[model samples]
Every structure is written in structure tokens, then in C-alpha cells.
Target: MTVESPAAAHARGAAVIGPIHAPKASEIFADLLRQKILDGEFPEGQPLPSERSLGEQSRLSRAAVREAIGILKQQGLIVSKPGRNGGSIVTRPTSQELVASLQTYVRSQGWGADNRTLLEMREIIEPWCAAFAASHRTDEDLQRIRQRLDQASASIDRVEEYVSAGLSWHAAVADAGHNVLLSAFMSAASTPFLSAADHGRYDSLKARKSTLKTHKAITAAISDRDPQRAFDLMARHVQGSEAPLLENLATTLENDTAATG
Candidate 1:
């Protein structure tokens, strides 16, 4: 009537268990270093030990130590400096790096070719971001948004400049929302949106003017601290803008299918 322990039952071939795989030495070492960096034990701008020293301390070979460092470097946890005074230094990832990583991830997921999906994501996040900006934005945030808005207005006839300014304005709004992740995501999404717009249909003067009008209205709503107005304006603005882009994408896809077939 006695029940056997799981470990003992497994050992006696009476229990089935998944295979146990040990992590590589490099991964273990990398995890240790990553934890230290994140925990502030290894503060930013401080150089890590030399490869030989790290190898000695970790009881790993030079290759294994290098592999660990490489993993950390790739993860944006540390930077490698060359020269006599140079080595790996603990560092946090920059905003630009985060955007780059997010862009890579988006592309990997096949989201680049289909901008409707990206627009759908923006539709979900941006209205709330505008609402938050309406409630939370500071004078400096207002000024930044105005600056980009003015730039967009001035560059309405210039496709590249207009798109760039428009994206910057959206990013400013996201930043004003006081949400770091949303701001980063807005920045990351900009490049792909730009790529899609570069095909020329989105740069029509009429469309630019309409977009500018909506942006100005959205700005006004945020300036007046009207979250509902800001939210509605942004929602409509995004939906209005998404239509032409989606239509263009559909046309392009159909043309491609016809050509391929």
C-alpha cells in the first residue's frame, strides 16, 4: 500500500518522464553574467573581467567563455571594446536597439509584406495612446508634437519629408502617452509604414492635406486634455489612412498573383 516517490519510480523504470537535457556550459555562464548585469551587480560602464580571467573564474574553456560573452553582446547586455584598455563592458540596451530588434522580429513574422496587420496593431494601441497623451502630456510633450506637426505641414508636398515628419509626430504622441513600450513600438513600426507608403499612392496632395487636418485636430484634443476627443480623432485618422494603404496592398497583391500565375 506504500506509494513510491516519482524519482525512485523513474529510476526503477516504473514511471515515464521526459528526457532531461543539461544546458551548455556557455549558456549557463551567459545566464550568470546576464543576471549580474540585470541585478546591478555588474553596473553599467564597468568593464567585465578579461577572457582569461572569466574562463578561470567560471571554470570554462576560452571558447566557452567567449561564447558566453558573445551571447551577452548579442542580447545588448554588454558591449565589446577593442584595445589595451578595452574589453566587454556591462551596458543596457538603447531605445534604437530595441526598435531594431522589434523591426527584425516584425519582419521575421512576415508582417512586413502585409501592412494591414501593422495598421490593425496601430489601430488597437494608438487610440489609447492618444487618450493617455490627452491626459498625461506635459508642455514639453506638447511642444514636441507641435514641432513634428509643423514639420509635416511644411513638408506636405514632399513625399519623403512628409512621411518622415508624420511618423515622428505619431512617435511624439506615443511618447507623450508616457508609456515606454508603446513609444518604442511606434518607433519600430515607423520604418515599415514608411516602406509601404514609399510606393507613391499615399503621398497624394489631397491625402496629405486630409492627414494634416486630422493630425491638427488630434493635437488640439490632446492640448485641451480631452481624452475622448483625442481617442476618437486618432481612431478615425488611423482608419481613414489605413483604407487607401490596404487597397493599394490588395491591388499590388492581385497584380503579383496574376503575374505569377
Candidate 2:
């Protein structure tokens, strides 16, 4: 029988005693790099170590290091340049990208309560966004908002059209805020609520008329560049609209429970 070297014996021991299901080397390296970036160990615009160096440091192959860098690039945490200074550089994460990823993740989780919570959170944030938009809106932005409002008003008889227009109007307000992050976040969060609002039993002519009036008032406040008025009107509009829907949902849920019981 041949005696194995100490290093070989240690390797055999590690194979038995180490993690039963360790992550792939590339994934492990990617996670380590991602944590380093988040921890500010790698500042924005700073180039990452060369693949060879990273491989040496991590005891991984060059291919594993490259794969890890590719993963980081996809996450918007780094970018690659192709030149003498060409390497992966740390980058600031864009809010749009972050929100998009988050939206996808939430949808994948198949959670209904998350959508409701998102709507509640938007109710808290979007009024401020509307107020900012009103304060800072240019003539062009106001004109665009007016066009959407007019379209919505004209389509009040058609539920689908009306719902589409309503969403557009809210989106216009968010766009007028001139903050991409705020706009993206509001747009994503409001999607399910907007769908729920559309399908609820609020499509009556009377409800349409009331909604139009409230929308008009809010638009007028925005057009007038009255931040306070716009904020107040938007807050009232959301609360007023949400109350009836919440009551209807609660009643429906109670009835369902009673019937089952």
C-alpha cells in the first residue's frame, strides 16, 4: 500500500467533513464579490481585481472568476469596459433597475397580500409625489396631463378605457415629478390596486361622474401649480376611492366566511 501525502490526506478529510452541499464555486465567489460591493469595500467606479488574481485569491479557476464577474454585471453592481483600463468597475445601482427586479421578484412569489401592502404603501408615498410634480411641473408636463385627463373624461362610459386612462393620469402625475425612481416605484406599486379598482363594482355612471369630478379637481390643482391643493386633493381622492372598495371587500370576505361556516 502507498502512503498518501499530508496534503492529499487533508483533501480527502475535507471531502468528508466539509459542507454536504456547498454552492458552486462560481456562485460562492459571486456572492462574496456582491457582499464586498454592498459593504463598500469596492467603491463605485473602482475596477475589480483581475480574473487571474481573483482566481488565485479564491482558489477558483479563471473561468469561475469570469463567471462571477458576469453575474455581478447582470445585477447592475458592476460594468465592464474594453480597453487598457478595461475591467469590471463598481457602479451605482439605479432605482429603476432595483424596482424592476423587485417587481419581478414579488410577482414570482405569488403573494396577494404583498400587492395589497404595496398599494397601502403607495397611498402613503404617491400624494407627496403628486405634490412635487405640481410644484415643479412645466407647461409641457401640464399639457400632457391635461390630454390624459381629457381622454379619461371622454372614455368614462367604457370601463376598460376608463381604467386605462385613470392609470395613465396617475402615471402622468408621477412622470411630472421628474424623479425616475419615484415614478418607477409608484407605477409598479399601483398596478394591482389599479386592476382591483377597475374590476370592483364602481363602474356605474354615478361612480364615473364622481371619479371624473375628483380627477378634474386634482388636475386643475396640478395645472394651477398649487402644491398644497394638489397634495390635499390627491390624498382625498385616494382615500375616498379606497374606502368604498375596502368596505366592499370586507363585506364580501365576511359573507364568504359566513356561508362556509
Candidate 3:
């Protein structure tokens, strides 16, 4: 008796496989809608086709169309409202929620979203954000940024107020770049760190002054439309901010431990 490997048998035309069956109508319809939505045919906050119309167009039962819509909803592609003047509307998913989801996934994989990771992310992203804003920003964008800066400067000596203003300043820079996803990522990468530093670390006048100086420098670079300077200043600023933040975290933890002990 002779035996041959499956690969050899297939090459000798002794084995064959049939084509895969077509996907169900519900899936196919879902895919079509998904593609169009992803392609921006369905702009955010706009209504999708009515259920009756969709079913008619797809030539599928209402049940199948409903299933297809359910799939899209699960993927966060659409928001549905059922009432007078309410329907399924395309959604503009923000980076905050998306980044949060990804962070959760990272945690599930055993990577903690810690201070070190947050600082590293800022080191990587803040410079790029500053540079992009320098290149892409308009006069109106500059005005928006200046307003945040003014707000921060006015409350520089106030702890919580300063923190809120400073966060707004960073958000302005992110928005000036006109990249929504990057804006969201900057928020995600910095929020925990800023919250910790603001509440526990930045009590010193020196730290506040240093932060204000660096912020001014970064803003000046962007105002001058100097991308390279913007990048360099932001990199320097984020790096400089890390040490104080770590100290702040340590002090807060030590205080808690002492109280408990």
C-alpha cells in the first residue's frame, strides 16, 4: 500500500475543496452599510435610511435588516433613537472613548497603564502635536489657544484652577492641530498624570513658575509658526514636567501610608 501527503495528493489532483458559501444576506447588507458609513457617506449625526426603505433596498426581510443594523450599532458606527423625529444616526466616535477602550484591552493583556507609560506617551506625542499645530494652525486657532493661555496665566497661583486652565491650554494646542484622534490620545495620555500632579505635587511656586515659562515658550513657537521649535520646546517641556510629577505621586502615597499606619 502507498500513502501520500495531502499536499502531494492535491498536486496530483486526488484531493479538492469546494468554494466557500456566500455570506448570508444579513451579513452582506451589513457589510454594504458598514462600507458606506466608513467611507463617510453617512456623516456624523445624520440619519440613516429608514428601516422600511433599507429593507426594500436590500430586498431582505425586515428581520435581516434589523440584524444588519444591530451589527453596526455594536461596532459603534451608529446611534439609534426611536421616537418622533428620531432614528438611527451616524455617530462621530471620539478618541477619548476609543482610547479608553484600547487602554482597557491593554490592561487585559497585563500591561498596566501607569505613570511611566503615560509619560512615555506624552514624550512621543506632545512634540508631534505641537509641531502639527505650528504647521496647520490658523489665526482663529491661535486666538483659541491664546484664550486658554490667558486663562491659565490668570489663575497661575490657584491650584485647582490652575490645573483646569492648564488642561484647557493643552487641549487648545491639540485642537489647533485639527486632528481629533490625536487630541483624544493626548487627553488620555496626560489626564492621570495631570490629575495626580495637580492635586498632590504642584504646590510649589517654583514648579508653577517653571510650568508657566515652558508653556509660554511652547506657545511662542507655535505662534511664530515654527514647527521645529514647537517640537523641541514641547519635548523639553514634557520631559521636564515628569520629575515633579513622580515626586508628587510619591509624596501623596507616603502621606496616605503614614496616615494609615
Q: Could you say which candidate leads in lDDT? A: 1
- Each candidate's lDDT (Cα)? 0.87, 0.80, 0.80
Once fitted onto the true fold, the runs of candidate 1 whose alpha carbons sit more than 4 angstroms away are 1-23, 81-86, 107-114, 198-204, 241-261
Across residues 1-261, which tens digit of lDDT does each residue of candidate 3 receive?
Answer: 886767787898886664589898889998999999889888878899899999888789999999998888877888898899888988866566686765555445553334566666777788888999999999999898888888888988887778777877887898899898888776655455454555544678778777888888888999999999999898878777356455667998999999999
Error of 3 at 144 (Å): 2.1
Rank order by TM-score, top first?
A: 1, 2, 3
Show the colliding residue pairs in model 3. Answer: none
Clashing residue pair totals per candidate (backbone < 3 A): 0, 0, 0
Give per-residue CA lDDT, model 2, range 74-121, as digits (tens). Answer: 899989889998888899778778778767766665644235566566
> Which should have the higher TM-score, number 1 or number 3?
1
TM-score of each: 0.73, 0.69, 0.63
Off by over 4 Å in 2: 1-28, 35-49, 80-90, 109-115, 194-198, 241-261
Per-residue lDDT tens digits of candidate 1, residues 193-219?
A: 776666554557987898899899999
Give, for candidate 3, the lowest lDDT window spanning 10 residues: 105-114
Candidate no. 1 TM-score: 0.73
